[model samples]
Target: MAAGQHFFGPWDYVVLVIVLLISASIGVYYRFTGGKQKTMQEYLLADKNMSIIPVAFSLMASFMSAITLLGVSSENYTFGIQFIVINISYGIFTPVAAYLYLPVFFKLQATSAYEYLERRFGKASRLAASLSYTLQMTLYMGVVLYAPALALEALTGISKVAAILSVGLVCTFYSTIGGMKAVLITDVFQSLLMFAAVFSVIIYAVIDKGSFDEIWNIAERGNRTDLLNFNPDPTERHSWFSLIIGGGITFLSLYAVNQTQVQRYLTVKDLKRAQTALWLNWPILTCLSLSTSFSGLAIYSKYAACDPVKAKVINSPDQLMPLYVVDTMGDIPGLSGLFVAGIFSASLSTVSAAVNSLAAVTIEDYYKPLYKSIFGKSLSEKTIAIQSKLIALLFGLLCLAVAFLAQFLGGVLQASLTIFGVVGGPLLALFTLGMFTTTANEKGSLFGLLCGISFALWMAFGNPKPPLPALPVTTEGCSSVFTNVTVVAEPQLTRATTQQQEYFWLYKVSYLYNGVFGLLSTYIIGYVASLVINKIKGVSTQNLDPHLFITPIARRLERTMDIPLNTKELSDSQEELNGKYEVNGKY
Candidate 1:
């Protein structure tokens, strides 16, 4: 086979088309057969009738996108196994999401998670959180949609624009028509396909390489198996501190407050079932993460001696997995197509979820209030449902526009995580203030959100120098060598001198800590600001509801202060007793 050529056969194309058809068919089936989505609840929450297994699978599908499938392999191939710490961090935080945050939203029966913000703080706080989520998910959807297309164009010799358009259009069709049901049902199918694709690559790589021991031996020798780096340096990219502490905060932002996961949590029948679904996601997420990490190790084993980067077979680490798929599985007919379909499945599930969530936030948080205030009337259910579909369509187009520009970003995993940290951090802080503390007023929450965003942006893009490119590797084991190929040397860095130390200390923080920094900054600043305001105005915190705090914290405060914390229950009973007294007086 010649270099720079793809080997997709006619059968492969047929298989790809079949995958696309099945996704579209599910949408059509739901549109005609499923009952009409007459209200926001039915349209966005699947009528709150979703079962545990499908919701669990849908949650996994939403969280693990094409970025995880391709980027995780590439990350492991380049940086080693330290990325696995994310799974450990998730294990610790998923339950926090279930018990700490889920009950509040569930008890409130929230359509948008930001609705809780409105009740606890004010409308301004709610709008800030809602808009922040919209921006974050919009940016993320573009990368998710672009990743597979970028890989496909590199491996299959197809047009990048064509791949992006097809993915965006098909996802939009289903999500807009069938609503949440289509997204959920299709997600279950896609999740299974994703597992199959990853398993196939690992199984084939092991068979072709002779044994698992041999693969492990090759990776260990190549320095791809190193796991723990306990270095305490904040600027080091993948240290234990960075991955565990930084990653724990990052996952909290993702699972606890992000609209996508919250929407999934709201779909189940009851709080018990929702909690069960949250716990069930753990094993599935673990399986997927391990599969991708091992697949990366397998790739390293296959190309250990003849690095594709040095051979000029692939341009970037992200392209390595696609090159492997086409070169190794292309001859297997439909197998190559199934793998590509799996990549598309990952992309579609993520983008569709984003579109649906974006639409829900825009209508519920932004549009409904603005429209009512201006017109002095609420929108009918039919009109609101139609508007929601149109909003989904608009967001799909916006995602495509952003996809074209995503090529300029760094690696998929880095870009996605950075966006989550910088955007999601502030939003999570707002929700934390509302749920965890009663003294945080609307002014404090809004101030904290703004400051958190500003600080995160400065930390992320404050430095002027561009990042150094990754160092090159070797291809000494290949059968044939081409002349006139030169490997680029790694760039050297100079120590900072007194004259060069102009930037602030915070500017030097790693991207991994963006979430931690953002969360702490927002909370601290907001709390301090609230204290100052209370001192100046002589405002009292006595009327603030204690139930808004975490249950244990609220209970402890009640016992210490000798105050009643069951305000809602007490108020109901007091009203009933007053009616009895009035009746006795009348007699």
Candidate 2:
């Protein structure tokens, strides 16, 4: 399962210890420098004064965690080179997010990015989206928690349960205390460690494999080519179309609408600088993603013929990749620890981002509403900050429980693939309607959002609930006994064999298609519903102000600090309301 794991040794423990020290030192520094500032904005949004490098790097770190590193590597080990196709699809989404979607929310100066949903649609739709995000992110980070634990358990002989609890608790402690500032800064450190870990694995693979030319030849024969095919077809699964379209929609929502990334953008000086950060992100993330595939290729190149994984038999395919690492990669010393620690970086980045974003929604969307309703007053900034930490604690425990349950599921890739479109497809549709079409008013917004959710939910869980498939009964080092058995005696029940296996291409396509379908369905359905609403009201689309749907960055900058109402731009800024200038005041 692990492709080219020619290196694993006991000294790996020393390497892991050093990496842990580096990670912890950053946690301590953030603890010291930013310990006293606990106001809600400072705690939650990092005071909204961040620039492109820190924020962009933070976004990259968040997306490239253990799930991606381990999952993508496992994918290539099993399915061969097609894993690269799926990830290349994920790479091109950044620019689309910058150009088509980011400006509206930036101009609004939104605290909760989903507040855009509230303004254009209604509160119910907003709450539903935000709440769904919280649940999904919690489940998502839990999966992140579960992945590296698999690797750690295999390498160290640590209990898998212990590994999960350890990582989850540590991440929760740092994220809960450090808030956004801690998440951002720690992410930069994690990213560096991750890069070092990946490169070490690759370098070791280069030395362990016969030679570079020989490795490339094997990979080429295996068809590990073409990182940039555009349509290889949409429904075809992991083709270029699915990756670009599917990845585009998912990252668009992640960058433009999801609060985790949005919170980072808000920390920047202005839209221009935030966008500057956004533009820089694509190449760096593309590199990080490509490294995962490179690790997979190295694994395959090293472990092709007499797969040493046969030495320690495991039922689950997910176990194969990690087992290869411990048994084979461990032949070397510090290298194994660095690679395993790399997996840790992936998981930590994902968990920190998820917890921070979840806490933000809890404080802003849920608690703030309740506080205002009861006190008929606003709470102090300090109270909101305290509440966010409590929310982080509650959700961190919830996610830990989910991580324990994820171990019951199939391989990590399948677990992630299974939930791909459940809510995201519909959420994508609802947001598109809200942002683009004026006729998508409250009625259309609620209807379209619900329809999107129900449709995706139906597809994800409604399909025949797959109780894990049965693997052929086997001993360590499977011998393909079918040939020997057929030679000796006539077969009774025909068995599943090479012919029974699904094609390799589909393995990539399944994940890509779920996302692509969700995005397309939501957009088409929500757009149609908007047209219907416009007809019902006997209203022309032209009546709505164009600026609301198509606001530009330069125009928004010239407005006073306040987000203004849709009105004819007045030549004068002199008008005052109750001793406050209307245009100059924040909404």
Per-candidate TM-score against the hidden true structure:
0.91, 0.82
Error of 1 at 219 (Å): 1.1
Number of clashes in every candidate structure? 0, 22
In candidate 2, what are the lDDT values of residues 511-552, reduced to their tens digit?
Answer: 445545666666676677767876877754432323334456
Instruction: Give me the candidate number with maximum TM-score.
Output: 1
Please give, for residues 257-297, the per-residue lDDT of candidate 1 as tens digits. Answer: 88888888888877789989988988898899989999988
Candidate lDDT (C-alpha), each = 0.79, 0.64
